[model samples]
Target chain A: MPIACEETGRALTVRVEGEIDHHAARQLMEELSRRLDAALPKSLTLDLGGVAFMDSSGIALVLRAYRRMVALRGSVTLQNVPDQAAKVLKAAGVDRLLPWNE
Target chain B: MKPVNEAKLTFWSRSANEGFARTAAACFAAQLDPTLDEVNDVKTAVSEAVTNCIVHAYPDQLGLIVLRLRLYPDNTLEIVVKDSGVGIPDVDQARTPLWSTGGADRSGMGFTIMESFMDAVKVRSRPGKGTTVTLRRRIARRFPG
Candidate 1:
């Protein structure tokens, strides 16, 4: 997985690419946590446009991000969700827990 | 029904193999000419099953994990993932949605996702023995325009 992170005016955007399974999700969670803690942004936006595939592990990643943001008193949203990833999120009902940037 | 095609793979219960197993299953499933959705569904289900073996079945040490694939004439794909490790004590609780002992990072929705994507999912396990997950799905035959 390739992830790019940038911050603009206290809002951080992390764009992830490639497949996300339990294997990759472990690294992703660690990296995201490190970045979120370092940046302490007012809000976080995850861009998944480049992701080719995802599974239930994606849900854990998102939930971890949400929980981390909550602890940091920040907000989080997901954007550019692909069809395949969207199906998993919808199936797990994570689509209802977090807001998506259309 | 007898399978017209079949394949088996054995690998260690390592996280890296998660991708390998799913990709391998998808590759084998290609012969069925499944749609992109169908292919993704299979890959996702396989990932979940394999992850269970890595995370739950063999939580501590490395162990052997086996994946078996079969295709029937009716266009059905059957995938069997077997692991000989610490088995589930309660299968019902394990299958419940959002029920995971995998700590904070786990959503405990692996079984739910597999069930949603696959046509049928059967889980058989024995404590101190191992666990086997069988998933089956039918691919809709599509003719090119």
Candidate 2:
């Protein structure tokens, strides 16, 4: 997985590309959590435009991020979610927990 | 239903191989002419089963995983994922969502996802031996005569 992030003011935008599966999610969780702790952004936006595939593991990562953001009194949004990924999220009922940006 | 097609896939116990296994299964089932949604369901379930093997089965050492995909004449797709690693001691507890032996990083919903996506899921395991997970989903297609 290729992930690039930039911070503007109190928001952090993370652009993730490629397939997000169990293997990639492990490293991604660690990296994003570390960045989340440091930046302490008011909102975290995950841009999934380039994501071609995702599984339940990807949903777990998003949920973890949402939990962390809630702890900091912030929020998280999922943007450009692929159709297949969106189906998984809907099945898991994660679409209700977090907002969709696009 | 009688099986019309079958495939066996073997890979290392590495996490990077999880995606490969799922995509491979999807491709194997594609010959049955399953819809995209059905294929996604299969891919998602395969990922969960394979992830369990990588994260829980052989966390310390790399092992081998055998994945099988069978297509029945009735358009039913059966996916089997087997691992010769540390087997689950308690199958009941492991099936509970949010119940994980790993750590907070694990969502512990692997089994739940598999059961929800597939029509039927059967898991067979033995302590100190190995574990095998079988998932079946009937595609909305009929074999052309």
Candidate 3:
């Protein structure tokens, strides 16, 4: 699996270890939703450190999680975003909305 | 006049093909010796265009998507992504941010991303014909300002 999740305290940490394109996003959505529903944590922290690239598909995935977290009255944090992926988020003017670290 | 270099790719409209499409376009543009940032911009544009085709063009079915990459004599790169699926009814509404027919998974920022990453993005579509997105960007060597 390209996605790994762990429930640490009040935050659900998800580490994606590959490209975040459409193909990967599909599987990611399933896993993420399961975790988000299984336990409604106060926060969802996505470690994009391992993501080599991202596109609108990845952005779509992030948006899905963001919406879910919002519904749960939680927040989403994107950490260690790669340059290519960051460029995509910045172009969409969403670098701030996601509360990214790098 | 013919372009200095060009490549055309046709792939099945599976969600899996989106990343392949982007990497392929980036490799094609790499021949121009563009800056890493320029290459990233092209990749982002390709990603948005191709994702739109897979998600919107054939919303319920699978189809073929075509990508065309051409490098001109003026260091400008042009990318064209086309799909034979359903066409957009209103290109204007489709281009708006957060305006999505793709339900929950889409950001509705496909056109915005393409336009922001590339110099220009033009869309052409008819009711049942399909949609074609043309993106052009001029890459230049960095100069100390």
For candidate 1, list the clashing residue pairs, or say none. none
Candidate 3, residues B45-141, lDDT tens digits: the string is 8988998888889988889999999989877898999999889999999998878888766777788888888898999998789999999999884
Chain B of candidate 1 versus the native chain B: what TM-score?
0.98
What ordering of candidates by TM-score runs from best to worst?
Answer: 1, 2, 3
Highest-DockQ candidate: 1
Candidate 3 lDDT, A1-99, residue by residue in tens: 788888988889988888877667778888889888997999999888998878787888887888899999999999888888888877676786878
DockQ of candidate 3 compared with the true complex: 0.69
**Error of model 2, residue A48, in angstroms:** 2.0
Error (Å) of candidate 2 at residue A57 is 1.8
lDDT of 1 by residue, A1-102 (tens): 478998998999999998988888888889989999889999999999999889888999998999999988989899999999999999988788889976
Among these predicted structures, which one has the highest lDDT?
A: 1
Error of 1 at B139 (Å): 0.4
B1-145: candidate 2 lDDT, tens digit per residue: 6688888989999888988898899899878788888888898899989999999899899999999889887778889999999999999899987788877677777888898899999999998898999999988855456
Report the C-alpha displacement of residue A76, candidate 2, in angstroms: 1.3
lDDT of 1 by residue, B39-145 (tens): 99999999999999999999999999999999998999999999999999999999999999999888999999999999999999999999999999999989734
Worst 10 residues of 1 chain B by lDDT: B136-145
How high is each candidate's interface RMSD, in Å? 0.6, 1.4, 1.5
Q: Which stretches of candidate 1 lie over 4 Å from their true place?
A: none
